[model samples]
Target chain A: MSESNLMMHHYLAKYLRQERMPHIWCEGCGNGILLNCFLQAINELNVDLNKIVVVSGIGCIGRVSGYINVDSFHTTHGRAIAFATGVKLANPELEVVVISGDGDLFAIGGNHFIHAARRNVDIKVICANNFNYGMTGGQYGPTTPLDAWTTTTPYGNIEHPFNLAHLAAAAGAVYVARWTSLHVRRLKASIIKALQKEGFSFIEMISPCPEIFDRYNKMGTAVDVMKWFRLVSQVRHGCDPAKAEITENEILVGEFVDIEKPSYGRLLREMTSRVQDKLKREES
Target chain B: MVDESRAVLTGTHFMSGDLACAEGALAAGCQFFGGYPITPATEISERMSRRLVEVGGVFVQMEDEIGSIAAVIGASYAGKKAMTATSGPGFSLMQENIGLAVMTETPLVIVNIMRGGPSTGQPTMPGQQDVMQARWGSHGDYEIIALAPSSVQEMFNLTIECFNLAETYRVPVILLADEIIGHMWERVKIPPAEEINVVSRKKPKTPTAEYQPFKPDKDLVPPMACFGEGYRFHATGLTHDEKGAPETVSAEVQTELVKRLADKIRKNAEKIVKAQRVMLEDADVAVIAYGIPSRAALSAVREARKKGIKAGLLRLVTIWPFPQELVSDVAKQVKAIVVPEMNYGQLVREVERAAKTTPVILLSKLGEEPHRPSEIIEAMRRAVK
Candidate 1:
């Protein structure tokens, strides 16, 4: 409608469903920033948008799939990876990306995540780790830090948080990386790398849930959390993921693992052909 | 395109119901199977795991029934005819995803080989106790298509029918089998693939730019466009509009979406529901049965005829949408209706409701044993008196 508005629209990614915005993310939430970084990575990769399928589970970040103008599936809670595995196996040509929150990807869907990684299925998993489950009134989840305050843990969370990058690497992900919302450029680059990787790739984003997570823990405003991320975050490329755990004192973030192996689809195809050959030989 | 020579194991073969079901699925053009091994249903997956590879199909043993059904639904959305098999306990775990499938209107098949159960009641034993659970297992007001197979032959035949119904209506179809039929070995005729009818989901004929995922056609069924086909539409379990976008706050959208999801099956009940009527012409007494119990009923009817008593059998093939009109019509001709089920009065409740004026006798047999022919004949005699 206006000259400036029209100019801004020109800069937006073509993959984004503009009509679906403004999204339902809370004001000052880092999910928007993470989404922008993801879009930027896709734009930089110059991927065919028609061949991309964005899948998400039930959570705040799961809404990301709906906002992206791709063949998307907003699936049941914690089943995005399982669903995405089917999508990938059904058609190896499509690029299946699962974007969801920490609770959905790690807690309820933990088994699927581990199994998919172990099988080395070709999928890009982007988990937004905001420490608490923001959509369900800020409940404590698997990623909630020790002593972190949440609605369910009003006193303090006694559970230890999962170092997601370490878990991904341990579970056989070919490429694993982690970054906070403050590290937009690094996050974008890592995302592009994961998207290009052959086997299972995972990227964990330590995002800010300012309205709930931050408000409960007295972690100041969203800007304060961003500043804290800048101060405490350390990026160590090619470091051992186990040594890169996030704590109250420091946040370790980097590209921890990047390797090559035969993907599940490739192996499955080979096995099928081998079996077919044996069957033909036996028949002869 | 299904290759009959490759997929169909033609001619007669003595096979278990579970194995026959797997063959039936293969003949029906099912390309994907995601399943977990549970008692009585394990043979189906084992057969599938071996046979699917030869046909260029995928068989994945998922972590549990929840993931199995989720993967099946996902594969279905990705343009594959997918299915899964489980027994009562695993079926209980799959109820959540069944609801998800209902909401998304994803076409897939689930074979529940029933056992005695409220909770793992009898894994090795046979029981048709899941009749009511099959109808009302998942939470919500949505309708489902469930078929009951009586013999090993019917198990083969009805598995194909279930897949056809699933793809025809774009709803999850259940082959509500039991351990008796699932484990029983009998002769099954593997029909030529050309002789068997298979249905695939209607794909969007319009351009991708104009395709709406949830917009129903004249039959109230929407054309599906798979992922990687460039349709670029969204699919969610939430209350969604015709464009496949979530519209949770709108009452009109929720009502229209849910009503269409249910009405599609209800309106097509005549085309979906099927039953068999044997010797109902001049009979004053009838025995209604399904699954394993129907075999006994058939025998009992013949014995009653030999004894100079007018008796018939109404075998339920399609259990859901409850064949009310058929039951009512049969009720009007018969003075009494005898229902012999493996459960304590599950389907008999529907029988009683439909046969308002007629005396409906329940001959429920629990535990592991099915109703003997003599036991059903005894019930029929009492109903007549």
Candidate 2:
């Protein structure tokens, strides 16, 4: 067996839920795929799983924590990031991972997502971008393709979907990338890199939800969803997201930027040290 | 009304419940607060912000309730006993991560000055509709300690108790003061710090390497190691193993984890519960009151005594656990019990079950106006008859 696959099996056996053997993720729902990739990466890094905190918010993607066997927090609709931020700050040494859906991350929790990214807190954020809110039936989300059919927006949507990469990149995320679930190996590799990177790393995985987004949009099962992702994904690093758009319907998929910035914790310590030093000098 | 002839010291100040809730939090050694200004609880956020700054603590008015709770949690992790207060609408916004504070076993106090609403029902008005919601608002079956103080003094004292219970159990404790208690002001004693037994969270004495965030110790709560302590540990909302990580999805880990989280509060119910009883001895009938309505009831109970009615008042200091067992005991002696609250009938339901021998009387002032003692006196008299 390939080393990555072998490692995944061991980790899955040691940590994953074989009982919920088949997760509720759509047949091709990249959520399980992305979750698998994340687990694989956690193992690859050989992170003490005990010291790894996984927090998820609401939506199909929010169930990621329930599926995994870790110190996991499945929070309310959009507060996973906030909760994750609290857990991370409360114990900065723990590797905090926030996994959620596009809607859970941006729409309800948009404020927290921006602030965390802007502060560059040490968090690895993986958002499963299915272009719709999957769990509550198909509802148009911030990432839902404009004109997509969902429960809320029966007519073709006029609202432009948020390019998540653009949002994170603009919000000062030091490490930002987008990848399709089809690129499992690459997705796993990016998760590893994101975990290892010292600042806020946002990796958007464009998974498809067939039952809701697909059925209403007249697309077929999970296979068809994966096939579509395979057909129209692109990537370019250090390029403007506006320019990196594929055909209007498709999303770009690849690591856009992986540069380092001083983390908030480091800054806090440095400031503390500087103040102490100044105090000592003055006393002397 | 001339107090200059009085020998005893007194501050007969009139304030709303919102002001008292903030003052109570300040007395609790809360060093950090993050909240957005929302009705019925706006004054709390405002007072905490000003006082926190004055005391070298922090008060960040975040973008919203979600951010407010996040910042408060962050400050706590930074080694400060942090708190946040909000009413119904803002309280709804904070539920997502409030559960996180539950799972991570993060010790912080949330003052949910509950307002009227399933969603924004009574922002300016008062509502006692959040009692059930407070007990089970978030999506988990985990236990939480909630205190409902009747007077400004209880508000001040119980806020400290909430903080102590949060630290003692290493879980989030809710100060379920209503909009009435949050705004209504009364003279409260600021006891000397040493006089109040403060229980700080267990700090890791062992090396950071040996620290397990959720290790079930003797107290059913593990010692917490904060950030910058060099202790590496994971805290999550996931169903985790003792070490606080995602564990192998085994029945054993799930059972053990859930049990410890629950047992901490359940086992220590005596230490966590608080209440006040007035003139219970030799009383044939009683009135149960909590939050601001109880203040009115206290006056009414006193008035009834003057009129030769053998009535006493039982103030619920700790609302959750319902003082259920306490009320049950009181139920046996009283002919009928009167539960007068601001809402339609929140606590009276608990009273009915507790007081099986007595006909539970409910005096509900469901509208925006506060429940006055005159109304409670009438209920107490009717129940006695």
lDDT of 1 by residue, B191-270 (tens): 77788988888899999999999999999999999998889999998889999888989999989988999999989999
Residue B153's lDDT within candidate 1 is 92
Q: What is the DockQ of each candidate?
A: 0.68, 0.16
Q: Which has the greatest TM-score?
A: 1
The 10 consecutive residues of candidate 2 chain A with the worst lDDT sum are: A268-277
Worst 10 residues of 1 chain B by lDDT: B1-10
* After superposition, candidate 1 runs with Cα above 4 Å error: A1-8, B1-5
lDDT of 2 by residue, B1-385 (tens): 1011111112444555666666666666676677888887778888775555444445556678888787676557656788888888887877867777887788888888777776868787777878877777788778888988766777776777888888878888888877766776667665555566667898877776666777877989888876445554445566787666556478898788777788888888777777888998878889888887877888888998999989898888888766777898788888888888777787788789878867888887775787777887787788787
Please provide, for model 1 over A1-284, each residue's C-alpha lDDT reduced to its tens digit, 9 standing for 90 to 100: 77546735765546777777778999879889888998898888888888999999999998999999889999999999888888887778899999999999999999999999999989999999999899998999999989989989978999888889999999999999999999999999999998988999999999999999999999999999999999999999899999998987799888999899999989888887887778779989
The local distance difference test score of each candidate is: 0.90, 0.75
RMSD of 2: 7.2
Best candidate (score: lDDT): 1
